[model samples]
Target: MSDGPTHGAKSFRLPISGRLLVISVPYFWLLLFLLLPMLIVLEISFSEARIGIPPYQPILQFVENRYLEIKLNFGNYNYLFTDDIYVSAYFNSVKVAFFSTILCLLIGYPMAYGIARSEPGQRTVLLMMVIMPFWTSFLIRIYAWIGILKENGIFNNLLLAVGLIHQPIAILNTPAAVYIGMVYGYLPFMILPLYTNLEKLDGSLLEAAADLGARPWKTFLEVTLPLSMPGVLAGSLLVFIPACGEYVIPSLLGGPNTYMIGTQIAGEFFLNHDWPVASAVAIALLVILLLPIVWYQRLEARNRGGAG
Candidate 1:
């Protein structure tokens, strides 16, 4: 019997090879697309910008009688640290993203919970309604908000018709508009994760708590809320991180006073032609954003260990 496959030797080599291939593809794609691009960006971040030349240039010039050289410089990072404008933009981004994420959570949690507790068919329809808006172009959706929030827009017109306001309000080009647009855009992200988690929660546990003389609010706080923590964290991260880097909504809906890090990076790269500075800013933003992810992972690991 061929020694019974040598008692756990690599007899099924083809199956192992197939499994390895399946696992390796995704990692290979990630390295090629994500990791390599990030490494390139990091390298560019450290390089000095050449005057009258783009940030990246071939080492050897293809044309005759033309010369090219690549140089490394850290001045971009130094400038970023010394300048106050970039620092302020970074802080503003954090603040705006934080508030927007909180607002999404406040609004989405209840909606998600209600949907999850509904009948299965109703839950599917409700969730579909939440997600259906995303089928349209995101840019167009944001632009639609512009028409609604602009001076003499639909909101002002409606308010005026009801005699709530005699004149159009300057809702456009304000932080409030920015907040509205962000919350609207990211609400689905917050709701979907929450719904997924809450749907998985065992209703019997909640019922048991109620049976044990607990009120509805107490049962929610003690049982439902803690169980939904994973979804909350996941959804918040999804919304907050992107909101921090948002440029389009702010630019279209907000005034000149509202400047985000993403907008600043765009100005640095395109308007100022300061590629090194843009790369430095990008790197800094990456670090700032990734710290929370790292911290979250650590906290999650500790929680899992304690549970185990």
Candidate 2:
């Protein structure tokens, strides 16, 4: 029996100088910024809280002046589960993030479709308008919504003036307000990806579908929608992850009933001064956010394999 061709191969290695230059840059950056901070947070999450500047007890200590003692407290993680507040916060965050993402999709898809189908000259103008809000500060935009959603605000005033309603309806400090702000603020994120994907769609595909006796709506359902799924996923993750951990919008617009992970984490760290629990919450939140990214990568890999 002969050895197969796949059984033997030569592996190439980079030169010492090339390896140093190519790998060192990214490795150095990750070490300094991403890995180091994450490691510090991970270590802190396992330690007990104390009255100190940093608010967490030292994990490593000299035992008997020779042996090192490592203190790892898993109580914080347990507390997150045992406490109903924390559990509810996580659930509410996910719920809000999910519905907000869907709302963005419904509104953004049409806007993106319009922009992508616009004339070349008009498309640039439309895109600029879509991006124009970003030129202003995000904080300022959120504050502006308070004026619109407040009971005595312009929106209510307009409705009153037009005789649409006898009185101002309460809108501020509610879930509806939070959703409105989220959709408004993150609309661009959803639209940009969708437009990018929709723009590159081959026009001939639509024409071919039409020739084959497919109606516009049916063609869109069977052909266009399937092709634009990647953009939908990308845009959804872009909105959902950040919204899951959103602090500013919820703080400004949401009432006491709005329980979210970001607000709970902030409360744990700043108000309660529980550093370990806060770190644990943060780590859990980070893990949650990374899941979609992982899923996207796997899907992309499967797609590439199928394409190949």
Candidate 3:
């Protein structure tokens, strides 16, 4: 009896400890990489801008009588609100991300639905085509867009050869170009999640709807659309979050009028050498991005509670 109890205790502890060890690895990795970097940025956001090697005044310093002094500059955050450039950039970034997400959803949903409904062998081939773009360098892909959207580029050449227009339209360095690049780059992010969700949909429910005299479109609205909501939300988040902070696409494809938060952060850090202000802007943007995730999590939790 004593041996049995000891063996049971060892087995119980082994799995518990193993589970904790596995969980702790990722938590520790996040703490080391994500949390530590964020804390550093948060610390920098509270410091003053300076012309030193670090380009920012340290917040912690030893004072007279061996006293430690902690100086926090709220001015960095205040400057963000006071400056119209930062304010405008924030709004513009959000606007671009919002519209781009909507466009992706519109385009990707159909593609995803089609793929999900295809034969199993065709599904793999279609998915490979969708994912093949990722095998190429992201920068190279964006650069390819530059060639395609330029005034005298392939797009305009095609239009001209077809007698569609008198001259090449100005697309490069415009908001339209930005939208094109965003949609092109992030389309896969939207499609994969939607396909995953739509593929797992119950065929029986769809058939049941059809038997109930629902038209295909009506059945889709009442059955398919409702079931695909999770995919829609996931894909939107995947697109929106990265698009909001996109720098390279905007810098390459978008004009001054399309100024975004990412551009603002870079300019602050590099051009102006204002580390505090840049850090503050970054932190503020992080907070804005986190809000949506927090809301989604709460909504998910509430839904689960209701179901329970």
Candidate 4:
């Protein structure tokens, strides 16, 4: 008697068709947007250069017998590997991304920790301040940095007024400006993830350490830092991936000395009109970036498995 209605209710679920429809919504979206573009780019990467709109020789051509002739061009891929300029740009992108991720971690961690420790009322305000940059257009924010970093701009003018320097120092159109723009643009990404991790930590863990006569610094090093590693990794990846392909910041802030993979890719596509070559370079960038990303994903999967 007790099991009859309850058991029947528990066993009931949405129809299989209904469940399949729900799953297919997001699956279809990913297939249409993400997977489709990747496949198209991968296809283009193997295409030959052609003179015309679209600018790439099709991979398949129909012969007289109705047999498809496949023309695969490895020249674009070969050119990327052979050219020292492309190789240097790849290395330069890695260098910039590495430094930017580090800087974001250093600057963001403390800010995130502070926010995590704050009273609930204050935490909201602090988070708002961190997110305030998003209120304005990202392009505008990047452009504004150009003015601030310029020799005759607000930063130099303020320094001059305070007698900190005899003349305005050159900061605009330099690698330093690129670094500044990256850190400013990507800092919040680092902070939000770190904050999410840190805020959820048990307070009693710290108390227990304090009770055991552990120094505050020692407790942090042992307890807090190790616990925040997941956040650190997530935030670093978030910053590193975008920074690697960042075109606008480097183009606007960096000089001729600061050529990156994005700049190289953009030049190949727009100026050279070599779609195949550009697509190959893009595929190569993804391959280069995959190392750290795949590692992180594997590590995360292992951690989740262990937790389960």
Those runs of model 4 whose alpha carbons end farther than 4 Å from true positions after fitting are 1-12, 295-308
Clashes of each: 1, 0, 0, 0
lDDT of 2: 0.90
Better of 1 and 4 by lDDT: 4
The residue ranges of model 1 lying beyond 4 angstroms of the native Cα positions read 1-29, 56-72, 295-308
Model 3 C-alpha lDDT per residue in residues 1-308, reported as the tens digit of each score: 23467777676655787978988999999999999999999999999988889999899999986988999999999999989898999999999999999999999999999999999999999999999997778889999988999999999999999999999999999999999999999999999989988998999999999999999999999999999998899889888989999999999999877789998899988899998999999999999899877766775676466545
Tens digits of lDDT, candidate 4, 127-222: 999889867688899999988989999999999999999989999888899999999989998998899889988999999999999999999999
TM-score of each model, in listed order: 0.84, 0.89, 0.89, 0.89
Taking all chains together, the TM-score of candidate 1 against the true structure is 0.84
Weakest lDDT window of 10 consecutive positions for candidate 2: 2-11
lDDT measured at residue 106 in model 4 versus the true structure, 0 to 100: 97
lDDT of 4: 0.91
Clashing pairs in 4: none
Poorest lDDT segment (10 consecutive residues) of candidate 3: 299-308
Per-residue lDDT of 119 in model 1: 98
Superposition error at 73 for model 3 (Å): 0.9
Whichever of 1 and 3 has more TM-score, that candidate is 3
lDDT of each residue in 1-308, candidate 1, tens digit only: 23455646765655988978988999999999999998877877877677765655323344556755445676778888889998888999999999999999999999999999999999889989998997878899999998999898999999999999998999999999999999999999999989988998998999899999999999999999999998899789879988999989998898888878989999898898877788889999999999777866775676466555
